[model samples]
Target chain A: MKTDPESHQRMTQRRQEGHVKKQAAATVEKGLLIVHTGNGKGKSTAAFGMAVRMLGHDQRIGVVQFIKGALHTSERDFLGSHAQCDFVTMGDGYTWNTQNREADIATARKGWDEARRMIESGEYRMVILDELNTVLKYEYLPLDEVLAVLQAREPMVHVVITGRHAPDALIDAADLVTEMRLVKHPYREQGVKAQRGVEF
Target chain B: MKTDPESHQRMTQRRQEGHVKKQAAATVEKGLLIVHTGNGKGKSTAAFGMAVRMLGHDQRIGVVQFIKGALHTSERDFLGSHAQCDFVTMGDGYTWNTQNREADIATARKGWDEARRMIESGEYRMVILDELNTVLKYEYLPLDEVLAVLQAREPMVHVVITGRHAPDALIDAADLVTEMRLVKHPYREQGVKAQRGVEF
Candidate 1:
């Protein structure tokens, strides 16, 4: 709203210079512990996006699915076949299908074993433990043991854990934590079916 | 916790059956209008993840970046070169940067033109208008005009708009609206630089 256009431009230009300077000042590099948890969607999707970025960068990545089970998803089909990715789905189904406690715990244990291998392998730059938080929530896998493995993994290995009900302890350990808050879901509101490509 | 194992298993099985029944009942099909907003880090990344899904399904996609400008990201390098994607970056830089008002408005206009083309063309199964919310929040483009164009586009085209401060009207129009809530960010708390293959 400044009548003097030159003065307005100068003010904006100065702010940009300050930003550039700040950007240049950051030099520390450390592998991040990232967590995605909440009631909304896109937690695992965002992790998959990072996997794509890693693959694009020519870095090998590992993906382990805990609660999603063997339901074929487009992401699994694509990433599993990619040369740079080692994708594994390790569950019979969701936890609510009578196998809630015992059977689910056994499945989660197997999944964690595979995930731990990928995290410590040193061959991978990133390891995605998809739906691991849900397993942790049910105490299917020992949270302390899982955290120890993550903390002691390869120096530059980034780990992404996603699922609802992330424990307070895990949040404290994470470098970046995003909660995908659900504003509106068609399935809940209008009984809309989970469509292909969008949902899977 | 039920001590009678058979009873507990039967109860859970019944619940799962009910869930399966509900899942099978939904039969509607329609193109989605999705909005990803909030102050969190994964808004754009999730949309890119959907782009990967669309790509995995072998469906062509169109991506038009609004306020991001010409930053060279790993995603751009990946998706731009992919045969199934048509990617275009339009704008100078972030809103706070020098070319704030006048210069930025002109850039937004051209970008909208490209987005409109993709939406109406029907060739692209999905079209992502990245950061269009920020431009709309700044009033660079008339809200009514953008809504009208979105409303009249191809019925089967999935359009995704992402950024912070999404307008209420747009939220009402979208089939899926997710707010990526920022629970924790390392860059803000620890001054950590945006690392390769994660932030970019």
Candidate 2:
């Protein structure tokens, strides 16, 4: 597998050339519909990280969390404190605790109302629908309705939706989709209690 | 496919019971060797997000970036400005930009030196080795050496290593590993230029 130095050099040059071409060819720019979903983790954390990047650029962002509202989390508190960020935690709590379809649907609708405003009003450069996919998976919000709203959002605003079991329609509609597949989760596999900073 | 509401309620309660049991069973606590790998976006972003989480808890963090020292990044600027964070940007630029093998190895070693200090010193609760897996993949630093250092690090200090093509040994050693699989990437498939706030 190890090529000679000259061959290695040629391969590197070719790779460099291809990279340059790809960079040059990528000229189109617009808003991105990004989805982060899978069984692993970092789905929402990555969105929060993107929100931080926007904040670093001094851009305003709106964050709406659909689930995990039952307990206090550091990310919610941290982002909310920033003047440029508007963070909202929705739902009665963990869906398991509620275990009521009507209540879950109601909470999802209320969260969607706030999310729809952020996506439609163009008030922020980036909007994060944290755990929206989980709601959609449970049919708390009609998938078609959510997709239609997302499809018609402002042209230059990026929206990141995160959670497990992202529907196929959303994946098809998304410009960027990353599935955070679990190789191994510390909490579930390693018997590690959800730590304050890591899990929350 | 849809069950009756009564059946659904029973299912929900059963799921809730399982959730509670899992939560209760997870009692072990220790520093984790977390790896973010695979060919996808958000590997480094997730690590940065974890740093933010630590910051939210008012905990100090050390971040050592391996390959992205090429351009000015908003995350670096933001974190560097924070009093509690020590951020170091390493290497000349991208791997393709600097295709010198010996030079690349030298740079990787230099960066690893700084990283070793943060990880071993235990001053910070979290240490982020951004793009370290890329260096490992290139064999710039012998995997065994890096693994040994990581294994001997302080018990309560967490280390997050990120990049694509994580070696099997690293995965085996990791306490948690989440592979950010590329379901779809806008920059490649959609011909979208890497956006400022999102890509960086």
**Count of backbone clashes, every candidate in sequence:** 0, 0
**Over the true interface residues, superposed, what is the Cα RMSD of model 2?**
2.0
> Which portions of model 1 miss their true places by more than 4 Å?
A1-18, A69-72, A98-100, B1-11, B69-72
Query: What class would a CAPRI assessor give candidate 2's docking?
Result: medium
Q: Report candidate 2's fraction of native contacts.
A: 0.66
All candidates: CA RMSD (Å): 2.7, 2.0
lDDT of each: 0.83, 0.84
lDDT by residue (A1-200, candidate 1, tens digit) is: 23245665777788888888777877667789999988887898889889888998899999999877422388888889999999889877777763557787788889998999998878899999998998888787888999899889887899999998899999998999999998987653466677666787
Runs with alpha carbons beyond 4 Å of true place in candidate 2? A1-5, A69-72, A186-190, B69-72, B186-189
Worst lDDT window (10 residues) for model 1 chain B?
B1-10
lDDT of 1 by residue, B89-118 (tens): 996778667454777789989999999999
Model 2: what TM-score? 0.95
Which candidate should be chosen as best, given lDDT against the real structure?
Answer: 2
Kindly list the per-residue Cα lDDT of model 2 for residues B78-186, writing each as its tens digit: 7889999999988778776776777778999999999999998889898989889888888888899999999998888888999888899999999899999999875
